[model samples]
Target: MRNLRQILLEEIPEFKAKGEAFLKGELGKMDFKKVSGGFGVYAHRDGKHFMIRLRILSGVLGKEQLVAICNLAERYAVPMIHLTTRQAIQFHKLSLDNICKVMEEGLEYNLYTRGAGGNYPRNVAMSPLAGLMKEEAFDVVPYAMAANAYFLQRINTYHLPRKLKVSFTSDKADGSQATVQDMGFVATLKDNKPYFKLYLGGGLGRNPRKGIPVDRLLPAEEALYALEAMVQFFTHEGDYEHHHKARVRYIADRMGDEAFVNCFWKYFETAKVKGGLDFSPEMPKYTKVGKTVEINHIAITSQKQEGLYSYYFHPLGGQLDYRLLRKISNLIEPMTDVHVRLSMGEGLYLVHLDGEEVQQVAEALDADNYLLGVEQTRSCIGVPICQMGILESQKALKAIVDYFKAKGNIKKSLPPIYISGCPNSCGVHQIAGIGLVGNKKKIDGVLTGIYDVYMKGKCTVGETHLGELIGEVQEDQLPGFLYDLASKIEATHQSFDQYMEANKEEVEQLLSK
Candidate 1:
């Protein structure tokens, strides 16, 4: 496996010269940089890829533009476009020669990919169902947009110990899953005005930990102030010695919650006294897809007025066809209040539709080779893509999904399961009900691909607890193996977690066998 730096040096011989020019402010073109967990591009390398993450107001884009963007990605980069976990798309591999043309196209579409990577503040992620969820107490989209606007063009907040992730949720539907972010704000109404329950330090990495609550409730006006205070604190007090320990979470953890909150409040009071912040604008509307042909995936016969009939489709490894996206956009356009919700699962949901539409949508998707379900269909960045990937998880996930379907024993109801390509666990497999981490195991003195089964935790971000591996199956045995595991879960009237916990020894023995 080649490090991104090595890959760049080998593939693009001028990489070092380009980087040197960039550093000297002499580079006429931009280039890429490899970071620990991910990769980034600097000022010179702004575009020239398959997909670019643009910082647009309200985080919205026109439908035709979106189609065009997808077409560009398919033509120049990868066939898939990823709307990142950070509210941006990763826009897979792009040829070095086409970067400038892609950037030019972005300008035409009112989109540009910058500040979506590096130590800078990432795109502000908000609940996809912000105002639409039945239980939402308030909408946080406005705050999210405000934050993005303030930080996007400005370089003041760019340099930090590590990347910052901010997420806001307006309801308990767990749309954005705030608890797993570096800075999180969940909305709750108080005295008729909306207040955000603030949390800090939650992150996923080698040392995964949930964020701690810093303030119970903060008026909307004070939210950005709180953000500034937190960032300031991180800049001044954060560890710079070890890169791994330099994240905001470490500072919060080292200072302790009480002290951190007290300091944050003090800064908030100072900012308020100085009259530096105000949030008088109405909450921004949910992100909209600009005008395009209407596409409808649901019909009245399949519509449901109540009871969890909707599912957000998180594509395995964040891969989606641009053409299919256009078709989906057309399918759902006629509905008055329909919105597409992007999930942390790296998938999107077509909400407020009935079962009929879902069936239609699913059928239409079949033509594109994208399946609909929440079974063993999960993935992480894999070989030739993510530098850290050891095995091909995207391919593995597809094979697993197909295998289960072909076995004729797949359950009507599926539990959450995730497959990770490597130990880095980018897929968040640790918290999954049934998780599989790809590894090479020696069988009959020959090394072969195998998936290690993990269980025993509520693996959704923030609420995650470490899971234990209970079994392993050869790559070829995964489908039948998973079927048996699912049966065990059903037979015991237990979630995958409970069954694994109860039969820990048995599971271990089975794996050893």
Candidate 2:
């Protein structure tokens, strides 16, 4: 990790110079992007401001890391720190003057931003409650953490077909989305020994695909071997010339299912012979780290640790108010073993706390968790910030929340709601609950915003499936349609999936109308 930090630090001067050239109009947009993506820096649509993503490995942000981020946010006058659906924090509206500084300072805490945006191995995601989930086969935090280190150390291996994403989930729920990553490891147990079922090449986006199993339970110790194999396989078989068909999923498609499996296995064997990647890290030690006032308003859940709990919160649309996070930092900074883990769904969990600590922290940073089922929506920072975005997805998320708040006591057992600005699935709209992809249509000459609706998708271990596209609805009509449907689901007293199963015709009628 120290080596990775030093490597990232050494590259800053060059990046700064290139950034300056771009600012001076000496670098074209595409040329600058080619240089900037590897550095995890992006200029705002205005071309004056910038934003940088800090990849928190396995979604763990220690107290030191959070405090450092807070200081930077304050130093930059950043009103909000955006949380991405992939478990990273982004500081928006940075200037070229401070963007490089932000990158350098982040390395002080060993938080690497390099390789975050490029066609490199992105953040290694994991179950936000990895060690804490009671149903997990075993704690996968250590292994996932090891893989993060392994990848960061070798990130200099450039020019993959596209960005590679890997994930580990401690249980079948696939909370970290192991079933939908380029290379996935879902923890399992055989005779009380921890193992992982490998899923390969599944991802969300324009041509979404569910990961294919390698047909065997991988020994937990050999997790890194599997990951390294993916790197090799992707490198060898990936289509370098075509941009759209470069992802690992495309390799699987081009090679055919059986051949893809066989080729990946051969690479896996080669990785094993090459050796040196043994992974058996000690589980993270949590010194029994609380009060009991009211952390249970909605966001609190118990950890596997007997008395310890984890508190959760979502700042609607994942735009965390810097002030709220600052307050939380102040509360947890002095405390031991308390840390934050950003969930893949734009929410976060405060772990290693007892009941007392939970209440203390919750009281200090007041928040209203979105109405559990139907109200909460995860969205990408679309339009202005994203070069690929087609809509203001965050504003759309806020609209959904505002609509529900205005309708008092509207109950729902709905699944997760995901909104993406476009078909790229940054908002993870392909799996689970209700999915919305922004679109536009010109009726006469007036262009109007609308959303392509998808429903009844699942992302659990054995049940992974893409969301079904039902129909398109005008953006303005979205809230009403959802509210009306949710009211009916509530009357049925069934979960969204269960209700949909029994009332498919009725649900489709509602959606169509």
Candidate 3:
């Protein structure tokens, strides 16, 4: 039986054809949810407007596409572009009448918004530094792009048990958070041939689980086939009767590891017989897409590939000023081939730049404080825009940054922190060194906002683990506590993970109480 979302997806073209009348509140409540969510248009909690999420697969976007998004937002919504945890762009507070126009306008730039929401394969993420990073095993962009393109082609028509999350990682050290994905591909080299380590059934949001390894080594050629098999297994075996337990993770949880693995193998063997899908091993090479500028002096993060350097710009909680982005886009327009990657951390990365162009890039971005790194922290857009939001997390993130600055530790190296407005994990709190998910507690008979704390999460090439919850902190108490926590940790250890390993009991006693 087709899911309600798939049924809705099939009818969207017709709804879109009756665009004006449909937008004018002609559809019923259930029909509205189906028609809107199927096309990535979500009603704001207030029900007065909608939000459209764009599918920015592979976390990369071109200047033309960026400008198109800005134009759409400026003309219709609040003129602000939101960057989501999945590395996609979102437009908020848009009216129903303007959604199709915005989506249609985006189509001109080859930017599509379909399958960005609902029970479908959403954006496929990979390490934003894929080909440009020096430490990567090999470029995984080709594979990531191939998977994204393949899925998007079928997303509009395919009915899934629930949303499927997919990811790929080229670098183990900075492993694209692949362990939390429904299906993950980690790059490896075996016998001088590119291969991948496959992981399955990992996810966060109410029930968090790290992906279990399916294979130690899978030939690169079999990637697409393996992906197909996984989807097939999920479609047939996943629990559709209970919406809450429809994800692949729940299915794996219900069946023990041995049973789940055995079932997956059956699908895998069948797919293997069907043969490998088309794949390319070539890496993208950018050779000056635009003009070039000379640089006298400017320091960037690091030189990845001799003569090419990368720098990151953050847009506080992923809310980018469309006007500023346009300026930055124009600034790098000279280096036409330079890749602009939308990082999962909600930052923008300018990659593959000539050493000489660094000064001009820095100067252009410096005027507006865009070069500051405070936005490095991951945060989710909070209430009341998000239907599930429990706290205004972005505001809390700003408070943390301000506290760091006041203590003169703004630039100090601390553990990676992630803030989610609720348990949905939109901020990826599960994998953070120190994670905070907002909640409310009754204090003195009054409900007060607080954050549930998670500590000791780890993500690497071979393993990914969700952090353990220590306790909760009152909203008013968070800044001071975080400062003390950072100071105490800095005094004892070089890294938070190391500190946790050495003083688990002591730390737990200190925080949980």
Candidate 4:
């Protein structure tokens, strides 16, 4: 694993020069993007402000790290601290000068931003509740972190056709969305020993695909061999000429699932023979005990260990209030073993807390909390923030939640929504229950913002599937359509998926309206 000291001395200083040049206009927007992304910094749509993504491996954050993040937000006067669907956190609306400073200072807290973006491996995702889930096969966070450590250093020099995504899930819950990653491992056991069920070639975004099963039982120690093999395979066979056709999913699609699996094994075998790829990684074992608290709320869940609990707090749309977090940090500062993990849906979990600590945090949320709804949705930083964005995805989500929540019909029958400003899938809308992709339509011979509506998409384990494009709705009409569709589902007393199945014609009519 690469240390903070080495990155600070070597990679970061090199990036500083490029950042300086970009600020001075010595580097063009397109030209600077080629270098800035590797450092986790990118030019905003405005080209004046920048955003930096922090590599929070496995989405886990210690108290000290949390403190530093809060401090940095205060120091930078950042209005919002954004938690991503990919389980990473970002600081947006920063000046180019401050972007570089945050990257260097953030490393002091081990919140390294290096290799957080670009055409390299992304942060290794794991179930936010991996260790705490009552039904998990075993803790999977350690192995996920191990994979993260292995990839962290290589991303500095390793070039690829496109980015690689990997994940680990403790059980079938698959909260990490393993079925939609370039690679994934689900915790399992054989003859009373730990093993991993592997999946490969899955991906989201333009031409999204569900991964195929590659191995049923792989020993825990040999997991890294698969990682090494995949890097070798993608680097060797990936298409360099076609920008959009270079992903692993495209390769798998062209070669067929069976052929892809067969070819991967050859690389895996070669990797094992190549040596120096085996190691053991262990999860943290919590040992504090307290009184059991009855779980009556959707946010509060019981951990596998008696007398311990975890609290789910979704700062509506994952745009955590900068002010609220400072207060939350103060509340947890005196607690023990209370760490936070970001959920795949852009929520967060405060785990390893005892009854008293959990209640304290719960009370804090009750006093001043972000509201939730089936429209408790998440979206990418769109428009002025994201250079690739076509619409204001964040604004769209807020309008939906604000419109629906006021109707006083927040229920599970209406599935949570996901919105992507564009088709790039940064919002992961392809796997949402109900999704919207930002688009443009010619209205009265002039361009107008619109959204492509999709329904019945899901991320269920072993049954994951992409959402189908149904129709388009003008941005202004989206909230009304969602409200009408959700009301239809509620009237029929069926879930969103069930309603879509039973009332396909009615659904289409509503979208057309």
Candidate 5:
């Protein structure tokens, strides 16, 4: 059988040479690792694009620091900053020559991009309003930080069979989508004390499934220990011969839940006897901001809370302009306890805005067409960038979105829709209520972009499954196609999920023909 890595090397010889050099540590000023997804590095290459995923511990940062990073990025890298779904900022398209300088600058601000790449645990994500939210059962930010600290610089877990994703949500907001990650922790109270309800083996790829509950409840003190044991168990027992079968889910499936739990407990007991750190250190108490500043040319909406309003700003493609970044930094400068939250759709929210100041930010943001077009749509850097991408999905997404908006009858509250650039589904399109997976189709003797429609239920790595393609629509035909779908949804009076489930056979028959 042809190895996947060999195939990749045959296609991109330059990448292979770099990979060999990378393994030998010949490439200076660059960090390299073979992650579950693929090999990645922190060094810059000529005319090659790089993105830095900066993990921020503090809720706010100094304006000067923001300005400096922006200047450095614009001078040596891409002018725009990409904010990830995980509340981290990714500085994209930087030259390899500037990696050292960028790392040095990051140190001054207490920010680093160490584990953003590679197979290592990437960013540890939590609810943006972890402690401040009224509905929060417990603050999970500390636990997320603990996980990051524990895993950082640990190379053993970095080179795994596949990429790993983890999330924590402290409230009922469901903001973290905890049920669909490799390991998810949902905050809950047990015996009137803080704890987490653990879910494991959830992931999305070619095969999508929702995670199963390995442990229902783990006290805050045991959270880290349990996680460590779980990781160790997977490392020892996970399949290594077949790359596709190497994910944690397969292990859970083969071992069975009871045996998996038993193995986990045995490892936990051993680790406890070793006397390693059990929990993260306590974080400083967050203080409330005193005064609010006005934002101009933006859209501001009131939150469920009386004093708080959510400020929305469109950073195109989730790229933050230095000027805009500086302006946002200055606007919140006066507030003693300001928090900036990154949204999954590449939008940013200043969450704790006072009622009076919402108008100012809204006015400033309104100058640009932040609300217009499908530019707001999310897509992974497909095709030329990702090794796995077979088609270009980002630009196609923009076109699809524009077509629907032009129809003028688009539903105001459609279920979540996502478009995947390729089968890898890095964009998480599979989990969306209405998903479009990219494929090539011959239209009138010409190859054109067409998508396989996946609808109903969630598209997770294991539990949630990818649906049959209901139909294929030409690039320009999306508006009409979706309009018909909307009508069908209305006629059924069922949610998109329910309608798809009830009519699966019919939908599949229509698509196949």
Candidate 6:
């Protein structure tokens, strides 16, 4: 009954021994991929380099960890760090010769990359503001951390039919996009005791799905048990024979919801009897204090804990310079007790700061073009790097941002606009208000990159639906199109959400013209 993860872990030492030979091509690519992927090292599109994704549990990292990551980027990988949507740090443009060194260095800082890339459970995601926000139903960090610890080295969770993503949301802000995960834990309070509403079988990518509720409320303490059973069910029953239909969602779809749950309980019954999953319930440690006062009109920046403040800094296109990151880390680590939280939106959130410290941080970052309302525009690593990309999504995002700034008509609080270089939706285009998925079409008798534009997509409490494709626009025409759309919205609607709700036909008409 050994799972793929257990087998891989047992075989890692053998792969590590061949690392030098693999780098020199004395070994085969297939063998390298098998072992490297199990260790979270992925071959880049160029086939000569690699990318290593680190598992920063729940996107939480200490100052020392940040310094270690920056050091690794400088020494072995790309000069900059790439932040993923799932809140993990990716070190790209690495050589196989250096990857093992990177992995060994990570151990010194207590960071890990194993299971970060494989079908094994990826890094667990949680609301970045879980412990800091006053509006949270309950702080879900403890549960998130516990869940991560449980699955981190467990052989059963290392590999699955496909990647299983787990997220814990503090409240309906749903920053973790729990509804769209393989497993989601939405926090709730039952008679002042913490509980979670369980969601299962949700995912995005080629075949997107919103998870259905498995339990309205499961006692929070039993989360590990439920997860263990769910993992067992997927491990034993999932469609391993077909790679395309390997996700747990496929199983749920084929078996029907009632049947899926029935099958789940059979596994659950066994896991319950086996025991050892139960743990002492310790409440989340952080306390939210004081009222938040906005600084610079950026909603992500706020004052919490009386005099202390929090600031969210977005590195445009999720690229952060290693030296700058190290500088920022040094400045804050010495002065405050705050641990940095990497947001799902691909930004950094620094909490527990005094007014003077906040001012100093802001002044230091004023020159970096650190975006004020970066959530307005997002993009994926596109053409030039990503093997699957059809267009330059990051450059396109920069163009759109510049266009809006020049026009001076677009609101800072505009709905999220996502641009993906392909249908893979790494930029989360499907969940955006204005989404653009990259593709190519014949223009002037030549193939040119373009975007299939979408509108009205949402991933919120009352409304959870993917964006509907409205039209296509040439890459050169996108900035103008966005400018015109912003102007139209400014002239009529109070918000982008309101505009989308009322002007679907009008938008279609605009696109036609």
- Looking at model 6, residue 329 earns an lDDT score of 82
Local distance difference test scores for all models: 0.61, 0.85, 0.76, 0.83, 0.61, 0.76
Superior by TM-score: candidate 1 or candidate 2: 2
Identify the candidate with maximal lDDT.
2
A best-first ranking of the candidates according to their TM-score comes to 4, 2, 6, 3, 5, 1
- TM-score of decoy 3: 0.89
lDDT of 5 by residue, 1-513 (tens): 123223333433444456456545675323333421132233333325444566653222344555565666666645656665556676656544354356545655555555555555656666666665677787777787777666653623355655566777777655665777778888889778888877777667666656776555777887778667766766787787887888777777788867766776787787777766678558546444424444333356544445666676765445556677767777776754455765555566776677656666666665642444344556665655445565666666665566666776445334656667777665667666667777777878999877777666453222454445567766555545665666676777887667776876765554444
TM-score, every prediction: 0.78, 0.95, 0.89, 0.96, 0.79, 0.90
Model 1, C-alpha of 190: deviation from truth (Å): 2.1
Q: Write the per-residue lDDT of candidate 3 for residues 172-255, one digit (tens) a residue.
A: 864467877898898888878898887788888889888888755888877888788888999999887887789998978999
Ranked by TM-score, the better of candidates 1 and 5 is 5
> For each predicted model, how many residue pairs clash, with residues at least 3 apart or on different chains?
19, 6, 3, 0, 26, 1
* Ten-residue region with minimum lDDT total, candidate 4: 366-375
lDDT of 5: 0.61
For model 3, the local distance difference test gives 0.76
Model 4 CA lDDT for position 470: 86
Can you tell me which runs of candidate 1 are displaced by over 4 Å? 1-61, 74-77, 155-157, 284-317, 330-339, 350-376, 412-414, 438-453, 459-480
Name the top TM-score candidate.
Answer: 4
Candidate 5 global Cα RMSD:
7.2
lDDT of 5 at 359: 62
